[model samples]
Target: MTSPVAGAVAAPASRRPAVALLGAYAVSLVGSRLSMVALPLFVLLTTGSATRTGLVAMAETAPYALSTALAGPVTDRVGTRRVSIASDVASALVVGAIPLLHATGHLTFTALLVLCALAGTCRGPGDGAKYVMIPTVARAAGMPVERGIAFADGTSRAASVLGPLGAAALVGLVGAAGALTADAASFLVAAVVVAVGVPAAVAAIGPAELDADDPDAAGSYRARLASGARFVRRDGLLRSIVGMVSVTNLLDAAYGGVLLAVWATRQGGGAPLVGVVAATMSAGAVIGALTAAAVGHRLPRRATFGWGFFLVGAPRFVVLALDVPLPVVLVVLFVGGLGAGTLNPILGAVEVERIPEHLRARVLSLMGSLAFALIPFGGLVGGLLSDHLGVRTALLVCGAVYLVATTLPALRPEWRELDAGRRRAAEVPAPGSAPAPAGAR
Candidate 1:
């Protein structure tokens, strides 16, 4: 079925909203990636403590996870457009304040943590709001949800590549504070792009308005949240996805937030190497995502997911732990990125199909929350491991854990559901159309 918001706009079949949404997402994500590199370096350089670096990461993500979980119901009630714009504006202000405070000699660790938390809080809903709009935009563009999400993933991967390179340049030329200033500017631009580019009517229709006849549409906040939670708890595949992703995310956080930073510092390549490392991986991911956009729907979901996870996990960690040559490290990470790139399209399409249209925002948010639940502690765990066990050992341990968490779940029968939705969709005849011949895709 078409999304509730897809037909809200009566304009001719156009891809304008979809393009705009993707553009805004890409711009904002570029800014976020810049900060992702700069912020860790900033903390590591200033405090000279891996533990405190982890602490700062925790402070930011803790609020992010909480806000993401809580924002689902609010996003369902408030228009996605409004929340997205407001969140971007707020993020710009909070992120901009960090550099300003530092320039004024007033920035402290506590203040930095507080600002990061505020930025994270603003970011959570903004990200979720944008995610909720994807299916609507896809339908509007006359595209399959998987293809659209693959494009979205491609943009994100592109941003990941550019953001790091930019971060390295900005940090080298103007310091972390300056890179942060650029990040703030990107948010403002993203906010403005959404405000002008996407049709207000299309994005402004919330679930409550669209699902007016349903009693749950008018329910209170707690009731709405409970309903979303109940839906996730009962879905076997989703539950498995949530559990597996939670572990991987936590390990990823530790790797990104602490271990990677420490490694860069030790190598004396500093921010530039970090950027190179990140950019290469993202570059590979960009290619992978483009490939997925082209042919993902034709592939078997179960095998794609299983192999993708296998490729994306463990290798980079092992390479780094082995202290391989720079070229060798880059090659491994690039291959991993290829695997990572195929993932979101499959996951996004499945989740969008499974959740009822009316419950999209709430359900997606809960899933995101659960998936990211342990991420806050990832940095701390990484830091502790690095400090006590040494960086090499920590990397090896994390790689092993990642290998297990992502691979073992594929053995479960529920994971076979990954391809079922696609099969069902293929079998259903469109309105006014004859059924396909037997064995037709």
Candidate 2:
């Protein structure tokens, strides 16, 4: 008999749901990138304080990390579809309120921070919910897992390129506050697209482990949360990835949130330069993602993961520290972006293949939370480093650290497992078929 997992994977393929999911992902990601540029510029322009800029960034990301860590069980229990929709709606309201309050001359820094926190809290689970839907939708579309994730990552990278450019243009044309209004509108559009276009079943797959009718199977929320954590703890490769990624994420957040902004401010390039630099890197990433989408499955995972990080990690930081001309920096970042592009598809494929379907949301959320746990402090650290050590020194220091964190782990035995998923896939018998005889090969 076909296993339920196999049966589900065998469901008649259609491209519609996949397209819808990617569409929603693209829209919301672009909005996020816009805010990423607009919000920092808004604070810097108004307050003229790097420390405060970091604080505001923290206000959003701290709650985001905490909420994402805790949201997995809730997402699994409430259903990914419902949680995703609700989160987007709440985020729109909270983000929209920022400009509205500012326009009314009633916006306090405290209020802005609070609004950012609310938006982050609302966004956390929604991101996890969407991530959980990827495998199902990929299978439904008959796309290979790695290819599907590559397409998704490519969509996101494309949005990154567009969003920064759009933010720069919007900020120039209408100021940061007006740009924020557009961000709010994008969230609403994403929610509508997901609701109308994605099939209901896409987000509702897997055994109903949390069903109320099966009280014994449906454990307490704490137990559910603990279960996911325990699995991650036991899995050596997952543990390694999470640990390495956490440090890298912290450094990346610092680069994006503080270092780049400060550089732009000091250089008198302001928001436009920041957008150009970011877009250049993202444009390169877009090309890299497309390349991965085409032949990633044929590549060696361990080497790709290692080299991709090596290329993406240290070069940008080194270039920025060098204070090279704009053209040189863009070229380095574009190359780095290419390396960065290949990473997620490999990581996503490994993660999906290794994780049990029933625990998808919780496990993925826990992993994401761990990876992002240090991000809240990233801005603050960047600010302090730039203030005390100078931007060039800080950039150099961060680059060295990133190099060590991302590359050293590849030497570990556990990293060999990065390629294990492909081997496993090759060995598995088709649904309803007997395994090949041991000597047949």
Candidate 3:
């Protein structure tokens, strides 16, 4: 649905792209975290094996990878708004199917896996669109992409905090399948936000020669794909940044999945412990979002991004695995979230800034695929490690790995390039967009 574009939307753009980007994403996460909580609970309640929950996780991740890989050109060709609206609805329908099937006694592992795959598929394309939208809006509004994306990432973290907590409550009250229905409802809500809340502002069409750098013009989709892949391979900063983020993501997924719950179980906190831990991290993440909103622009994004990995990664094990009290763990997570707040949007800005529009989706997808590819393995390995070495030991081991993965990238000269590529002096306003002078921040 197209609407008349409005004046720089800080005051009028429904959700304010920079902030709306974050808020809308936050709302989406509400659905995701709720599902994350509900799916496992449903499987556990129905089948009595915690391991069964991994199937749902697998389903979601598989499609996430596939869609991410394929969706980039779609983001560039069709524009982010259309892709976002369509994907959100598709995701809503898939999530809705879960509760529908449960009601009819048709819910089965096979069914759940299929649905999760569908959602993942939608999410990949949707995420690509969302990333494209962020820069487009920020450039239009004369705001830096970093602030907007950071705000968006932090908002996402806030939802991460709330969604699981809501899921836990809903699951406790209405049972897990019922929570799935609510999760489905959130996607519809997300669709509404993307379709209506976001301003339909397209990236400016420069002259044909100006558009010569278009990555998709390789004559065929497969060739375009190769072009994008080749571009990334040739870029030192982009490649290294992707590697660092990917490793960071892998470790985070491995350790952070049911992290607090595992620890709580060890310490004799039963079924409810998992929700509490998730909530703690969520709360930390929300606080982190606010912090990002407050300071994202002023800080050096490359450094901020690295520190974010350090904060959330290194401390996860240290704070949770220790023999400290539960309240103490909550505080640590809250502080850790502050770091989480800055990591995503900064990197998002970095990724978008360095790449041409044509390669955006492919690079983003490849990065996501590489980074998250091993999460399942991380889970499998983590689960086994937790079983034998104690959850605390597993967490500590993850923390040590986090240090190694995150540090290599942080120390690289390429990080300096990201800073140099988009300085205030050299900032290239998206073609046709008017931006404020160097003093805006």
Candidate 4:
């Protein structure tokens, strides 16, 4: 007999619900994008210590890695939709406290760090839950998986532009504290949208344990998490993707969190300049995302994904190392953002294509956790390096590190497995289906 979750996944997909999901995602991202700029800026401005800024960044992201494990079980139990809404609500409360404490003069440096970490912990599962819902959303909307993921990625990039611009304007008018308050409000609003707007059939799937029809779905939380990890380990392409992303994310976090802010401050740009720099990159990302969403299906996944990494990774560091004028740096960031934008859509498509439906949440949680594991250390190290080695030397070294990391996937034999696996995936029928023809595409 078909399980209810299976029935839900098998429902006729529609564009309206998909649009609603995207809308919710976009709203949540607006807040996320604002915090990305405001929180780090807050630490840098208030503390005037690169190390302290790094500590704040570290505090926020460290829980993200650990919280993924916790998120998987909860998502599998409560359903992705409910989990997402609840997480957002919790995030709203946590993030809103920052401004409240600041106004009351009770917000200490340590308190800020703790609150940031609390928010990160809330975000990890919320993000994972939303990710898990994508496949179901695609199925319900009758949308192609690649198209759905591309839209998701594109929406995020677009928000990156708006969020920074809005945050910058808010900072000018009311300070970073005020921008953070706006961030909190965004989360609450996003929760309401997701809860009310998303279709019930697409929103919740109950506990995975009840889905006897799903081979990969049964098991205790630990076993389920381990199963996902094992699949990643055994799959060459997945393993390579996870490994490369882990290193690249670590390096990128440093640049995005500490390096960029410090560079702007030293260059005499201040907080608004920091927002401008971020917005420029995000604008490029929007273009890249739209292009990918339109034509990504025709592109060779390996070449486009790998080369995109090089453009995004190498240029930012090199330009910073050169100490070029701000305009020149902005141009490089724009180009790099274009390349960066193509990456997640490809990765999202590949992930959804490879993992079993039942294992989406668990595998995604593991993947996110593993990918972000080094991020905290990256920010901490970047800050210390900037302090000890100076920003120029740090950029050169980190840029070189990024160059090495991005280049590896192109040459690695395992990376080729991505295409090979795609072909194999195309040949196999989806769950509960008869086998495909011998040479199905």
Candidate 5:
């Protein structure tokens, strides 16, 4: 299972320093994922209101947009390892507060939202650090940049793919608060792991030419912001990638936003079946993630992304349209999940390799934010379409939109260069880079 991903290629298994740092990063990501699963489940059980569920989801999401937007620059200014550790420690405190508040019997829903929002703020920086740190670790380990990215992506998939069910099991055994306690514990573990492990890989001196400490590094905060803007704007490869992925995000959000409820209702399966659907999707994605790791680094990143999107996108329509039993649905969903699983890690590796270390966090955050920016819109659209347009019709519309979005980048000549990113060094920066600094580019 030793795939050729662009990561710590220093010594196969002999690179102890690199391995330690990567291990710490992986642990931190997994710990964060575990908390992500526990938080929502805890909320649902305490108050079985879908409205509240949606609201909580929104609270978490709003902060993600805001935090994700800024995390990149902050990560660039401070060391990613330090930020990762600090955020995890902060996250631990926030998640731990939930149980503490509940224990003291003052855990109002509004208070819960505020706490979740605070924790939500940490997610962006923490996420940005991982992206920013990967290449540094890969370079330290002498691993291929692609392999480094693949390893990171693979670990994230493995950690997150299993988080929710584990949360549910904990809830069943010790109640939601207990699950929250464990979530808090995971954060602490992650913080400790990063502190002890990641420094070796990340402690290297970065290029001062890109240093935020240089008052002349850029200009105003707005100018610094624009640097990333211009990079993304002018980079044909980045533009194509972001456009296609953004579309996929929108369509997936549409279906995911409403699929469980709609499918259960259509299939005459109850609310519990929603859990079954989610589990099936997760299982499928886990399988896909593993498969992607097997083939991702060996193949061209662009090809992997395109084929994977095809796999992830095409079957979704056919599967959702079926009236088969839950078992059958699960099987097809797993197959579909395989494609879905391939997306994040492969592209994540590509972006890391293409961008500079100092700008790594900002570029990754901007790209992720754009790709996922439409989730809320998709969710709302799905809900509305299902209510007024029928589930099957909604599914059809989503599928069409997905296809259109994923393929849109292929239409332009400059974007065609994206397929050649592995061979091409040139990029057209995003207009947003102008906000970073006047002379940034």
Candidate 6:
């Protein structure tokens, strides 16, 4: 989960904050991705049913919407570091218990569902907090925002690359149960890293008196959350992204949460094949992230964004729908993942560019929570479709929807506002910030 910073030159002391924050974020992300493989694998291996896997996926994602909504203002109040550390501690214990309970012969479907929900609940805020801290970490490190964001995106891709492969190997060595154990340990280690690595000054929240310049600083938590929602509603680009991501995320959930597992189960290759497929996508993403890190600033926003979505979204389902050989599917996924890789860095750079630091957590949480609102339904529906219409039919339906959704932005004139907003934002200095150094490039 730790990575040497690529494409940025900064003093050692100056870089520590970004390093600590990004490394900690990557660690938790890696653990989350590991569970992405392990939890579904465990349920499928144990219950031998896609329905059960879907239910577990529902349990895992359902609380995230609620927790992230509530966690936003609290994260602003209590500080990202404390929230992250406490959440990871709780998550580690909860995930660790799944294996222990199974060993004790006391793990039931009900208990497992509850534990998965708890883990998701704990992570929701931590994820928000980590994101909110990104600008702070980057500024403290004296790195250009674009390159810093690219590094962050790349690290996440790196983690995604490692998580599935690591989970697959762990599952092979000691079993799916053991893989869950490793996931738990990763969370604990992430907590420790956050606690020890990030400086108190950088990680802690300052007094409300320090927010005299931030207009939304004095509001009630509800008002603050509402302000964030209002900002996104008013901003054409943010609104477009939220709308697009909400549907795409739902489709993605179906693919990751149920479809892949079900497809693997039916194909008779099981978890190992599932890991191999996911790893291919992740590997492509790594390449894409590195490519983005090198030349993202030079890319046109609208065309690149739309085409990236096109490459990543529709093809997987189409490939799967054809019931192609495993090698063919892997090739498709790798190509799709390459397209997927260009997305987040661009999205991250744009969103971070527009949002003020004070409202970052609240707005990010609100936008993210709303975007993910339908994910549980995606899992549930995918399971139902897999069970009822057969997996191939379900794949075609999802792919068709995905194609339509990703294509909307390119044709819509409202998206032209993205370039306008970027120009306006570039003209204004970020609050409490100075001009970037000439050497930042």
How many residue pairs clash in each candidate at the backbone level?
Answer: 0, 0, 4, 5, 43, 0
- Which digits, one per residue and each the tens of the lDDT, describe model 6 over residues 1-441? 112543334467867878887888888888888899899999999889999998898788778778987797778777888888898899999999999999899999999999999988998998888777776677667554555677777788898877877888899999999999989998899889888888767763474633654576777877877777788888877888888899999899899879999988889989888878988898888788778767876777777788788889989998988888888999999989888888887787688777766666777888889888987678788989889999999998999999998886657888776556556656654434555667662
TM-score of each: 0.85, 0.85, 0.85, 0.82, 0.84, 0.83
For model 6, the local distance difference test gives: 0.81
**Ranking according to TM-score, highest score first:** 2, 3, 1, 5, 6, 4
Ranking 1 against 2 by TM-score, winner? 2
Candidate 1 per-residue lDDT, tens place, 52-100, comes to 8877877888898889999988888777888899999999999999989
Ranking 3 against 6 by TM-score, winner: 3
Report the lDDT of model 5 for residue 157: 63
Taken over the whole model, the C-alpha lDDT of each candidate is 0.86, 0.86, 0.72, 0.80, 0.70, 0.81
Q: Candidate 2: where are CA atoms >4 Å away?
A: 1-13, 40-55, 100-110, 172-177, 204-216, 258-275, 321-328, 383-393, 428-441
Tens digit of per-residue lDDT, candidate 3, span 345-413: 677777777776656766776776666677667666777778888788888888888888888777877
Model 1 TM-score (2 dp): 0.85
Using TM-score as the measure, name the better of candidate 2 and candidate 4: 2
Q: For model 4, name the residue pairs that clash.
A: 13-140, 13-141, 13-142, 14-140, 14-141
Q: What is the lDDT of residue 51 in candidate 4?
A: 86
Prediction RMSDs, each to the true structure: 4.1, 3.9, 4.0, 4.4, 7.2, 5.0
Candidate 1 shows a clash count of: 0
96-122: candidate 4 lDDT, tens digit per residue: 999999899999998988999999899
Q: Which candidate, 4 or 6, would have the higher lDDT against the true structure?
A: 6
Off by over 4 Å in 6: 1-10, 40-56, 97-113, 171-178, 203-210, 257-274, 320-330, 383-396, 428-441
Q: Candidates ranked by lDDT, best first?
A: 1, 2, 6, 4, 3, 5
Model 2's C-alpha root-mean-square deviation from the true structure amounts to 3.9
Off by over 4 Å in 3: 1-23, 45-52, 106-109, 172-174, 203-212, 270-277, 319-330, 387-393, 424-426, 430-441
Clashing pairs in 1: none
